[model samples]
Target: MNDLVERFEVAFNQIHQHLKEFNGYPKNDNFVELLQRSKLKHSVIRVHFDLLKQYAKLRNALVHERIRDDYYIATPHLEVVESLEHIKQTLDQPPEALEFATHPVIFFKDTSLLTEIMTAFDQQGVSQFPIYSKDNEFLGLLTNDGIVRWIARSVDNNVVNLAGVTAKDVLQDGLNPSIEFLSSHGTVYELEERFERSLEEERKLKAVILTESGKANDAPLGIVTTWDLIKVDRRNEDE
Candidate 1:
C-alpha cells in the first residue's frame, strides 16, 4: 500500500518533470502534439497535458501496481514509451526522406532548362514529387505550387528546369499533411481532426499520408484524407 503510493509519487514527479520539460507549449502533450505543433507552441499545451496524464496513469500502474521491486515490471507502459519514442522518431523524420509515397516522382535533368516535368499523375499518386537526377542522385523536390508557378511563369520566363524549382520553391517544410501513428493499435478523435484540417487547408493534398509500419521504399498502406476524415469514409470519401 504505502510502497505503491510512494512509488507512484516518485513516478509522478518524474512524469511532472518530463511533462513540464516541454516548456508548456503543448506543455503537457506527448510526442503526438510534439510532432504536430512544430516545436511545442503553447496554444496546444492542454493536449500534451492530457497525453501526459494518460502516460502518467499507465506508468504508475506498471511501476507501482504491476511490478514488484524484486521483479522489474516492464509491461505495456514501458513499451508505450518505446512505442512513443518510435513514433517520435518516425514523426521527426521528414516524409520525403521516408520514401513511402504511393507514387514515384518525376524529375528533370537540372535547374536551368525546362526539358520536361516528371509526374506520377499518370499513375494517380500524390501531387508532391520526390525528385531524382538523371544520374540517379537525389535532387530537390517539386510541389504542386511549384508546378503551377512554373506553368504560370512559362509564358514570361524560360527558367522551367528542374533546378529552377526546388522544395524551397514550395512546401511549408515543417508543415505538411501528416498525422501521428501509434504502434500499439489505436485510433483517436485528434487523428480525425488533423485530417479535416488538411482537407480544409489549401495548397496540399486532401489526404494525410499515415506512415506507420513498412520497410524502406514502402508506400503508404493506409491514408486518411479529408473525405474519409470527415463524413465520407467509404466509397465517396477515399481521398
Candidate 2:
C-alpha cells in the first residue's frame, strides 16, 4: 500500500509539472483547477481531463485519510496507476503528428496561371494545392486530377490559350476537392480518427491542413496526408 501510494503521487506530480510547463505557469496551484482551466483553452487537454480529475480525487483520499495500516485502507490498483501513467505519457510526448506534418505548404491564388501551378507541382512534387480567393479566403483544394480533367476538356474544345487558364476556371468547371482543417496542437490519434471518418464516409480527403486556430483563412502551419500517418506508424514500429 505504501509503495502504491508513492507511485501514484509520483505519477500525479509528473503530470502536474508538465501542465505547469505547458501552460507557462498558471496562477492556480490546484491540479483539478489547473486542468479545468487548461481544458477551457485546449481541446487536447479536455479529452482526458475527466479521467485525470477522478485520479486526482483518488490521490487525495489516499493521502489525507489514515485507516488501519494492516488493512491497507487505500490500495491503489495497478490498472488505475497505469492509466494515470498513460495520461502522463500522452501529455509528456504528444503524438508527433504536427511535428511530422509537411510544412511551408505550397498554396496558390485562385487566379494563378496554369503554367505557374504546373511549375509548382513539378518543382515540389506536390499534387494538391490549397487555393484562395482574391480576398485571401480559402476556396478549396486544387488536385492533379482536376488539372488533368481541365486540360483534357480544353484540348477537346480546341482551346489554345492554356496559359490564360486559371485555378478559378477549373473550379468553375465543377472540380470537387476535399479538405479537412485541424488545429496545430492536434494529436496523431485525432488525425487518424479524421482519416477514418473520411474513409467511412467514402469521401476522398485530399489533405489535412493545420493552422493556428484551425481556420481556413489562416496561413497553414503544416499539412498531413494519409501517407504521413502511415509513415509515422512505421517509424514508431521501428523504434
Candidate 3:
C-alpha cells in the first residue's frame, strides 16, 4: 500500500515548489507567507490559495488516519495519493491538455448580469472565463475565483458603488486575470515551457484558450486546463 504520510509529504512539497514558482517577492523568511506577496494575476493567486488550503486538509487526513486492509481503509490513501500526483502534475505539466475535458466552454455577454456569470460558473465548474462583447469581441479573461477577490476588494476600491461601471469596468479595470492562447498547431511540450516560464515570474499563468485561429481576437473554439492535463497524465501512468 502507498504510505499516506510519505504521499502527503510529496503533496506538500510539490505545492510548496509550485508556490515558489508563482510567488515573485525578493525573498521571504517564511515560505507559506510568501504566497501573500505573489505578483501573479489576481485569479491565479486565488487558485493557488485554494489549492494550498485543500492540500493542507489532505495532509491533515494523511497524518491522522489509520490504515487497515481489513476494511479497505487504504483506498482513501490511494485516492489522495492519486489526487496529489494529479494536482502537482497539473500545475507543473507542459502546456495544454493531453486530453482536456470537452465540457462545452461557458461564457457570458459583457452586458449580462453577474448572476448569469455566477450561474455559468456554478454549473460548468468554471475555472476561468474569456469575457466577450456583443460583437463577440474579446474583452478580457476573468476567473470565477477573481469574482470573489473583486467582491472582497470592491468595498475598499469604491468601484463597486459606481452606477455606470460596466462589466468592462469590473473586467478591464485592473484585476489582471491570467490567459493563455491555444496553439494553432504545435507540440504540447513547446506550450508547457511557455506556461511554466510565465509562472516563474509570478502566479498568473494564463490558461491556453484552444481556438481555431489561435490568433488574437479570434473566437474561442474550446478550453484546456491544468487539471485536465493532470488527469491525462494519471491515465497514461496507469496505462
Question: Whose TM-score is greatest here?
Answer: 2
lDDT of 2 at 12: 92
TM-score of 2: 0.62
Please report the candidate that would top lDDT against the real structure.
2
lDDT of each: 0.40, 0.77, 0.59
Candidate 2's C-alpha lDDT? 0.77
Measure candidate 1: CA RMSD: 12.3
Of the candidates numbered 1 and 3, which has the greater lDDT value? 3
Report the alpha-carbon TM-score of model 1 versus the true structure: 0.34
Instruction: Show the lowest summed lDDT stretch of 10 residues, model 3.
Output: 38-47
Worst 10 residues of 2 by lDDT: 230-239
Off by over 4 Å in 3: 1-98, 156-166
Model 3, CA-based lDDT: 0.59
What are the per-residue Cα lDDT tens digits for candidate 3 across 120-233?
Answer: 778876667778888887777777676777777778555455444445656855776667776445335444555666767776665767666666467676666555545544
- Put the candidates in TM-score order, highest first: 2, 3, 1
- Of 1 and 3, the candidate ahead on TM-score is 3
| Candidate 3 vs. true structure, TM-score | 0.51
